[model samples]
Target: MSQPQPDPEAPVLRAEGLYAAYDGTQVLCDVNLSVGVGAMLGIIGPNGSGKSTLLRCFAGTLKPTAGRVLLFDTDVATIPVRQRARLVAVVPQHTTTSFAFTVWDTVAMGRHAHLGLMQALTERDIRAVSSALEQTDCIHLADRLITELSGGELQRVIIARALAQEPQVLLLDEPTSHLDINHQLDIAALLGALNADRRLTVLWVTHDLNLASEFCERIVLLSNGHVAADGDPLEVITQRQLAAVYNTELTVMTNPLSGRPQVVITASKNEARR
Candidate 1:
């Protein structure tokens, strides 16, 4: 694969004064953010904070009522859908397959943006698919039916599909929401390692503050469609911030291994009295 041509000085993706609404109900309000090349950024917020809307705008799948999204300085809306698909890939929250396609077959679908209609795939396409499978550690499941795979397996296959696109920027919406604890950690570790090796920019949307603290270098906390805090996890995931945004009680502590901030929900007994 050729080296990515990303501007180190400029953000790979930027949102300027983003605003969106449905039937006059505003969702995102004047949200402005930037994602640096080769950096992993996590977007965290309570429900209805417009996390998914922001991603959809970036993906060029949802047009905003206001604001503009730029990809490497060019407006996302100006780029053709097929061309944009090559530059960015989104791993949505929900994934389902009915045809029972083999893992390889499904992953190869990501290369459609690069091929002409009905055109035969070249050696390049096959190599890309193979590399993606190996990258996501799904090579063992290459020939397995997607329908028969477990949730964790299916998630990796979806990631492999995105990898096959060879995008410079990857946007994931709640990638770990449906997985068990072990799989969640596995996915987080995989993303960390992949980001280190490929230098692909990642924008991960998640509700788990601890996971974001462990994996992402920087995080943006959103509340009521605006940026509440944007900085290192230690700074953003504080007790005050969580209480304010989530409107709940919690405890924040330092992680011994990473030295980043970790959160714990305090438990109290109804019959116990201080």
Candidate 2:
């Protein structure tokens, strides 16, 4: 079966005039974001800045109080539940299983969208799961119970599940938030490789500005539910932008190897003022 080839000029994912609220309080206000096919865009912001909220809207997991989310020319809200799953997959900040399930069985769940009720895993499903395990380097943990895995291990398993969906777009929320340095780099390299190899459109939400700057092709900085800046990392991750949004003394420097900007929180201005 041939998949729909995304238009080069058009964005694979788009958020137009998005406004979301929780308990009568707005979380995302008039947010607009667009990402082309094979592009990796990072959404960065401080806590309560609505980065995750925006991602949830794009994933169709949360309905915006107002405005529409469009995924490849089709309104996400209009797509049926199962069909939508095949088009986009989301890896949330935290995923847990109440009961222990084998890694292989968990990854196989991603194929549910393509299967009928109670249908057995098809040959195609096996191939997809195997490929996902290899890409995530979790093939060794196939028989391990999810309850026995560490945070980093679980994160990779979750991503593998998302990859098994064969989605055109991947939505990630703070994927590296709880990971150690090595695991963080591992996930970043994996995402970069997949994006380059399969032309996967990715929108990732992150609090780590330096990591986002290094991997993301475009960065959208949000402040208090509004888009503060949108451009390349060099344009958005500046000292002035970080200070103003985070209320901290920040130092922005160039990475000699990649020539990308890196942000550093240099001082505790809040403590100094207090």
Candidate 3:
């Protein structure tokens, strides 16, 4: 079966008047955003700012209380689950499995959406899985158990699974969180290459201001369930904007190499107590 092509004229992903809640408490409100093809967008905010909530709505894992999410100009909620998986892939912050699955088996599960009932992996499927592993630099670990891999290696394998799905829009919720500096850079570089080379529409929720500023083409800052700011990194990640939202003293400096904003936390008056 052939995959559905996205409408060229419409934004790859869009949220209009999106509102979501957990139980009775609202998390996101009146959120409106549009992501064009191949754009790398970072969703940044303090804890409980609805960044993950919004991403969940876009990924169609959560439905909004009001308004809607659109993928390829079609309402995301209306898309079939299997079809949706083919278009939008999400890499979550954490993944755990009690069963021991090989890296290859885990990644190949991404092809489940494309395969017919009881259908075996065809040559095309094998190629896609191999390509995903190679792209994520985890082909050598294909035979290894997922539980045996390190944090960085496992993160790469998870990404390889998403790539195997051949999604047009990739949504990551803090893909680099908890990773060391070197691994963080590796993930960032890999994401950059995928966005540039494959033109994948990438949107990720991250708390690392510097990482978002350095890598994302645009940043959307959310505060108290509302969009506080949205624009280029320099525009959204300003000292004033971040200080107000984060409720802290900080400085935003221009990185000499990337010409992007780098966040620096300054000592607060309370620091004297320490």
Candidate 4:
């Protein structure tokens, strides 16, 4: 049977009254959100605020106990795993492999979704992998072992693997969490470019408020398993909202270069006197 054609007019992804629990402990409650086609949305919140959990639900790796996730107006749970992999790709916070796999081989794994059982990589699959590597600037490292790459290089390789899937939507959980400032900026810029050039629907969970503010077209702030704020960076990433959710003393200021909100941590009076 032919797969259901996506409704172009519908939101690319939507969660309705989502509820999830892990080990019988509720993590998400009544979460509702919609991601439009080609949108770049960032999910931000304090640790344990269900940011990753929500992302897992959307990725179909974790089934919600209640409610549903819709991809192009069709239920995500009903889609076959391979079909879903073709439409959405996920980049987790960390990737590990004990065996020595070349960067090219690791990236080529993404083509499994498109291949039949025991099938070899076709010309199209090879092209996709090569394109992904090139797009992520990882082509130079194709012959290197994934275990030998730096954190930044490894992260880019992981993203390249995802891009090899040719997914319409990308779901990432803290893609830059382990990188240094420079690498973080590099990854962010790469994602921004992909979003603009390919119109890829990007939804990522991040703790870096400033990164989210600077890069995301929209931000959703989760607090206590609920959406505390959802809007453009300026509107959702305010000092008031962050202070309340983060329970910390911080200031939100406009970046001189980007005009986006930049979060600044403020020292307490006791610390200031030291």
Candidate 5:
């Protein structure tokens, strides 16, 4: 692939005074964020803090109540859906719909934005799907049924499908929710590699703060419908900030190997008394 354009210019994504809510309840409050080309940004917050809600705005699934979302300095709403699909892909937390399609067929669906309703998979599309499977190390499961695979296997397939979109921006929501520790590490490694090698600009919402700190260049912490903090992972994942947002006591330490922040949840005094 050709070298991605430099980041000296405007950011690939910018949110200014963004506000979003549900059922007349505000979820995000005047959020301002900017993501440069090839940047890896992690979004973390307590439940109902609107990490997913903010992502929906960028994915064009949820319209913002106020403010502007610019893709390449152009309004996101003005971009055609097909054009937007080519620019961004979302890997959801989990997919529960039962479809008996083979893994290859499921992944090929990512190309729909580029093909007619009745169009067959062209050579380019096939190559793209195959390459995505290879990148995620799921090529061996290409012929397997989606319903028959384990959660981790299916997660990789979904990520592969997103990759097949050949998107410049990748948005992942709770990608490791159903995975074990090993799978979590594997997926984190893959994401880090993709960002480093392919220059894929990534926005990830994860509950795993340690993984986020290890893999992301920066992190945005949300709480009570506002951005509580935004900065380098080490700078943002402090014990005070986490305790306040998560409503729990926690110890923050630095990983000696990676030099990233690590969080250890502290037990409540009542529990400790036991």
Candidate 6:
């Protein structure tokens, strides 16, 4: 009888007891999370919740003051920069390059991990870059200058660049920040399609809990440097929890269309005193 084969794809990213800080001030505390292959995990929180910091830690850009981040069960610190880039790709909130590179050039740069230094672009790289641009619906803007594109166009280009990496895991920090509703839905649909077709593990940060609930299978809600809630969107995004974490009155209800948890913030009624 043939020996049983081990499951090759498992949890690709794990954060254990992660405590992070900047300039000696702690921003994240004892946060633990994991992303299995093909999973899309959404991170949501109010401002100052350290969601961006958490993404940085997972991307290996920021070292945790405490705890560890593991990639494929290996310490991320042990992974070389190039190898890590191949395994994980990031679409940061602000993607501003000093030089004025064309969109094609920027997108093709994602293939750097697969190419040796001083090597020419392979046919595979060209195909991947083209596919990425098409997936992000930015193929028409391919020849446009990076600085000439609008916010949404530029964001899609950056996302295409990350997709060109052909990474097993993808990370996006506030991907919908400057996008319109149409582009936001477009990107969300693209992410789902990519995960289903390519088995990409995604960890995305969002301030909009409704979008998080609609797009992700699981969510991690952070508040003041700690995970206040971690579970299904319906269970975790209750009115009480939202009030406590965000310091605002919110109505939590099932979305009529998607049947997912929908959060609506209500402005405070208390009047200011002289």
For each candidate in turn, the TM-score is 0.94, 0.95, 0.95, 0.95, 0.94, 0.92
* Model 2, residue 262: C-alpha shift (Å): 0.9
lDDT of 2 at 246: 88
lDDT of 6 at 61: 94
Q: What is the lDDT of candidate 5?
A: 0.90
RMSD versus native structure for model 2: 3.8
Candidate that beats the other on lDDT, 1 or 3, i.e. the better one = 3
| Residue 39 of model 3, lDDT score | 85
Ten contiguous residues with the weakest lDDT in model 4:
1-10
Relative to the unseen true structure, what is the C-alpha lDDT of residue 173 in candidate 3, on a scale of 0 to 100?
Answer: 98
Clashing pairs in 1: none
The prediction achieving the highest lDDT against the true structure is 3
Could you give candidate 3's per-residue lDDT for residues 158-241 as a string of tens digits? 999999999999999999998999999999989989998998999989989999988888899999999999988889989899
Q: So what's the TM-score on candidate 5?
A: 0.94
Candidate 2 lDDT tens digits, 160-237: 999999899999999999999999988888888888788899888988888899998889999999999998888998
User: Which lDDT value does model 2 have at 115?
Assistant: 94
For all candidates in order, the CA lDDT equals 0.89, 0.90, 0.92, 0.91, 0.90, 0.87
Candidate 3 ranges beyond 4 A from true positions: 1-9, 268-274
Whole-model alpha-carbon lDDT for candidate 3: 0.92
Q: List the residue pairs that clash in candidate 3.
A: none
Q: Give candidate 2 misplaced runs (Cα > 4 Å).
A: 1-8, 268-274
